[model samples]
Target: MRLVIAQCTVDYVGRLTAHLPSARRLLLVKADGSVSIHADDRAYKPLNWMSPPCWTTENTEGPTPVWVVENKAGEQLRITLEDVEHDSVHELGVDPGLVKDGVEAHLQVLLAEHVELLGVGYTLVRREYMTAIGPVDLLCRDEQGRSVAVEVKRRGEIDGVEQLTRYLDLLNRDSLIAPVSGIFAAQQIKPQARTLATDRGIRCVTLDYDQMRGLDSDEYRLF
Candidate 1:
């Protein structure tokens, strides 16, 4: 992975156009082929980024060097560098991946056991279904045999949805399952997350943690 802190200007030209004026910012170039620019204030969000399966080239011969990042989808991120404060590369090896919290772990198990709750005739393909990025919580098939990737979270928030979105992007790239859908499941879902999921065509299901595990009180039972 390469990290660069530079005084630069940025322009994103694609479905939408955005620009960032000359300023000192942190730039990241990951071994996975992803590139992102970050501001000092934001926690995790990048000012702009180009997801993997893209190409990046740097032109440093002139007074003002520039970096051009392009993807197959025709989107481009242009970074014009005025001054470089810091630049370094690191070899961070194999990642162990995220460990599920207690509630999240339980939710994954219960969802895997009752896959049909996601959709009629849905059958569990596997839990921790591996992808290039990370393991999907649950992989399933709908009534029509369409692929569905589910991400289980204790609390569904924007970051969770973003994680699921990345998984969906990678999962849909498989030729055998070139059109995989996604389901974001959690005990409680935030409004912003739900809105983003809906806009992305990913379904959202609120899990009833106790009821699904047969732990709900008797008075709450319908029968």
Candidate 2:
């Protein structure tokens, strides 16, 4: 990864146009050819970015430096630098991927056994519930005895919500499983994902791993 803090001006042209006036900003160039510009805030959100399948070029022959990024979609981002504050390249090496204390499968098992975590009268009807698309993580029934199809994840994102929506769509088509609803369960759920789920009439449940594991109690049941 290459990081550059520079006093620069930026402009983007494609399906739309955007501009950033001359200001000190951070520029990130990833090994995958993705580029992003960031202000001093907004956490991980970038001011603007171009994902992979893109290329960047830099020219320092002139008094001022110039950088251009172009993606396959014909989008172009041009940066003209007046001065460089700090610049560094980091060799983060190949990542080992993500390591989690408890995997999604484990969470599934725990939730299945402690079905009440879903609601007051909810009960696990089946695990790895089969569907035309794939197996749903958990099949349950709510207090009103409505079929509830659940899709579990370590972190609930839009994709997870989409998966549960697909399962609900297919399941509800069957008369025997008609009127099925969905619940997206995860340890952490993003705000956007929660909104999407709610708009789709799917409930979002944030699971507490430690609580579900009964780590606070010695009488934890693993059945």
Candidate 3:
């Protein structure tokens, strides 16, 4: 990875056009062959970028250093560096990606082990129960053997209820689980989400991360 901090102006000519006026900004030339320009404030989002497969040509004969990056589609990003403060390259060999702890994933495992957390006599049918649309967090059978499709979230919102509704609508179509019901389980459920779940006849259960994980507390502690 190559990092360059400079006083630069950028222009993007592609599906739509954009301009970033002269400012001190970061330019990233990644090993993946992608190039991106970033301002100081926008966190991870780049001010402008040209994704690979792309190529760049640099010109120094002009008054300022100019770099034009072009992709196969002929989309172009033009960067002019008036003054370079720093330029260096480093090898960030590989990333292990995100490893979440005490997230929805952990909650799912806790709930699955203690299926009773959901209901009395509830038995887990499977985790990540697949449907045509997508996989459900947990599929269980209540004491009466009625199938229950559960959607798990660290924070349950109206959107999570809506997601479960879609799964229920699809799961109920299958004769084998035609009478499937839904449970919206979360560590913290907003009142609006609870109301939406109730209106849709979906049960909402608040998970106790402490009790589940032996966490007297976790990252997102809810009362």
TM-score of each: 0.93, 0.53, 0.52
lDDT of 2 by residue, 1-223 (tens): 9999999999999999999999999999977677899999988778888865688888889998888899878899989999899999999776542333467879988888778767779888999887645688899999998899988898889878866876776787789867999989888999999999999999888887766675533333321
Query: Residue by residue across 99-131, what tens digits does model 1's lDDT show?
Result: 989989998998787787776698999999998
Q: Which candidate leads in lDDT?
A: 1
Cα lDDT for residue 76, candidate 1: 95
Clash list (residue pairs), candidate 2: none
- Tens-digit lDDT track for model 3 on 1-223? 9999999999999999998899999999986577999887877668788866689999999899999999888999999999999999999876542233567788888777777657668899998888755688899999999999999888888878877987887787689887999999998999999999999899988987766777432233323
Residue ranges of candidate 1 with Cα displaced over 4 Å: 215-223
Off by over 4 Å in 3: 1-102, 215-223
Evaluated with TM-score, which candidate comes out highest?
Answer: 1
C-alpha local distance difference test of each model = 0.89, 0.83, 0.84
Q: Lowest-scoring 10 consecutive residues by lDDT in candidate 2?
A: 214-223
On lDDT, the stronger of 1 and 3 is 1
What RMSD does model 1 have? 3.0
